[model samples]
Target: MAQGQSDPSCRRSPPPGGRSLRQRYSGDHLQRILLVRGLLKLLLVVAVLAGATAAGWQPATAWWAARNRPKFDTLAAEQGDVIEVINSTGTIEPVQSVQVGAFVSGPIVGLHADFNGEVKEGDLLAEIDPRTYRAVVARDKAALAARRAELERGAARLQQARREEDRSNALAERNVASISESDLDQAHFTRVGMEAEIVMAEAAIEQAEANLDTSEANLGYTKILAPVAGIIIDRKVELGQTLAAQFQTPELFVIAPDMRREMRIFASVDEADIGQIRLAQESGKSVQFSVDAYPGEVFEGKIAQIRLASTTTQNVVTYPVVLSTPNPELKLLPGMTAEISFQVDRRDGVIKVPNAALRFYPVRDHVREADRVILDGTALEADDQARGESPSASAKAEAEGERKRRHVWVVEADGLLRGIPVTSGIGDHRATEIVSGDVEPGQRLVVGVAPKDD
Candidate 1:
């Protein structure tokens, strides 16, 4: 027998109605191979399916990201002019404010004006009780008449005394009277006394006239009138209210000069931003503002004045900035708080990129590898070394080098990211001024990255 041949006694025979041992073994082996092959084919199919699903998911995910990724509208930075700086804030105020008050103590008899009442100069706003002033005027007039009558009588007595004194002196001179009789007969003393009486009467008349004039003034004060053309903002006096002017002039009303013209805004600029503020006449910075009352509406104004006086609150010093705004429709009211922004700087007709482009950081190894690839492909070794320098140092070097040294990633026409070098200038938190770059206006700039799904 062959070395590997199986003995018939050693091999187990098949049971009745069953296949032979060799046949059974062969069948079992074939079944196992088939099972294994089927299992391998199933595994291959499963792997292929998994790979296809992964490949299909990649583009969907990329498309979803491309569609949903944050997009920024780019602006062009040109050689056009830009304001260097601006800073300010303030409340709206009327150009002129007046406090209408009473000049005399009296009871208010009538109120002719109230809050929001429009008034002109010399308009009667209120009237006070005039009874007491009227009585004073009448009394002073009577006293003045009495004093004038006394003055006339004294003048007549003075004339009579002068005549009598002349007659007595003539008698003494003719020896018809003794020396004592001449002294006693002399009417000069009586004449002087009468003249003095006339002087006192004149003085009394003058005093009465003064009193009458004062009473007249008090009577005039009974009518409270507007001193300026304005609208009434406040009315403190009421009808039949007694006011005492002895201590202070009781306020009757408060008026603002104009509501249709320009208004002043008082805003405090932080110390950090104060350097930017200047007179509107000088800087010509246009300002826009909004208040809580009108959230979506923007109000326009010009910088009027920058006050030198600085106010310190909680140890933070700020300068007051005044802005003049028109209120043709009277939409802005006094005391409304405003949030203001001064257009300090702008670059036009130049390449502008999203601020995030300048801020984005690539992997350190990736940046080095990209630089190596660029240098290896280029013959200009000196230029490539210069380009490979740190951004800050390069920025300080030649201006063009500063512009051409920095790079940002842009999705290429082939759906792959590529590096584009650029030079950047002034930027707000939202956008950056691109000094030099291949980027164009209206091109989309990536602002953020989407997180990879697990």
Candidate 2:
């Protein structure tokens, strides 16, 4: 190209080396601008991220705190008494059970009573066939009569003999008869022999009379009668059934006296709990119970006796406790299974709290410190220390020992929680008694706090 005058293509184009330099410079500028823009974008993103982190910190912390803070339900701790210990269990049984048995052996001719039948004293229960006994009695009577006749004949003979002996003696004395004949008559002693025979016959008659009385008495025994007024719970004999009394008297009936008057409940207390049972013949203290037959219903009774006899089964020993209850309505029957609660102890108008309240623990240091402050305000006896000691140790020793105070959480007006110490008393598995504590009737106490996601 000419100087200051150039062809179109040549003007548009650069020198080869020059064009390469321009291309390189434009690429470098574009790269530098892109890098600078990228850096500014990175700085803007960093700033935005920093602002977001700053904005979220307080809220996230607050949410975490809210989740971890314990919440509570207010309860009152009132003064009350409680039974520290008691435990037992057993079965229901009748105080007295009578087995009615036959006195004499014979075929049961008739049955007048059966199971569950009410009866009175002297009431006829069963009868045996009296034919054989009657025959025996008749035979004895006939024997007695024969003996009486024999006695009378002997007496007449004795009278005749005596007269003869007297006549012989008189003849001998007067010399009207031969002396040898009088001596032979005296030797005979006819009256004395007759008198001995009559005495023997009278004894035989008396024996016969006694035998007859025995037979009659046996005959009376054939008619079975109730010895006491009661209800018949069981009858084993049937009409025409033969009973043998050769070895043992056959049981024919079982009776219970006056079901409407009273009933006994038998409960089996485990050996571990038996020590708590107190037996009394006349304890005014009452008990309540229910049977599966009568759901949701309650029955009342009084402690009657604690049986000393212990029964062991399958390596477990138990004692039977008996309670007497009036069955005036005859609602309770024999052999009923009962679930019973013996009023071992009771307390009223006492301060009580949910068991969980005493088991609560805090997470935050400030909250824990606040709780300590509240607990210190309420001074309570250190009974828990005593509990930790040996049971055999004296009460005074336990009282004087150092105790670790128990703590619970209470919500303050500022929505913060604080720990409060309390003295615990008699407690069931569900609730505990507050013997002494700063907690009021309506102040809420925390049980547990929910965990938060970090």
lDDT against the true structure, each candidate:
0.75, 0.74
User: 346-434 in candidate 1: lDDT tens per residue?
Assistant: 66655566656665544333334445454344436557577776545555576455444566665445433456668776565556667
Say which candidate scores most in TM-score: 2
* Predicted candidate 2 versus true structure: per-residue lDDT over 326-398, tens digit per residue: 8877777778888877665445767767778877655555374535554444333335445575555576666
Give the lowest summed-lDDT range of ten residues in model 2. 373-382
TM-score between model 2 and native: 0.73
How much does candidate 1 score in TM-score?
Answer: 0.67
Residue 443 alpha-carbon offset, candidate 1, angstroms? 6.4
How many steric overlaps are in each model, in order? 9, 16
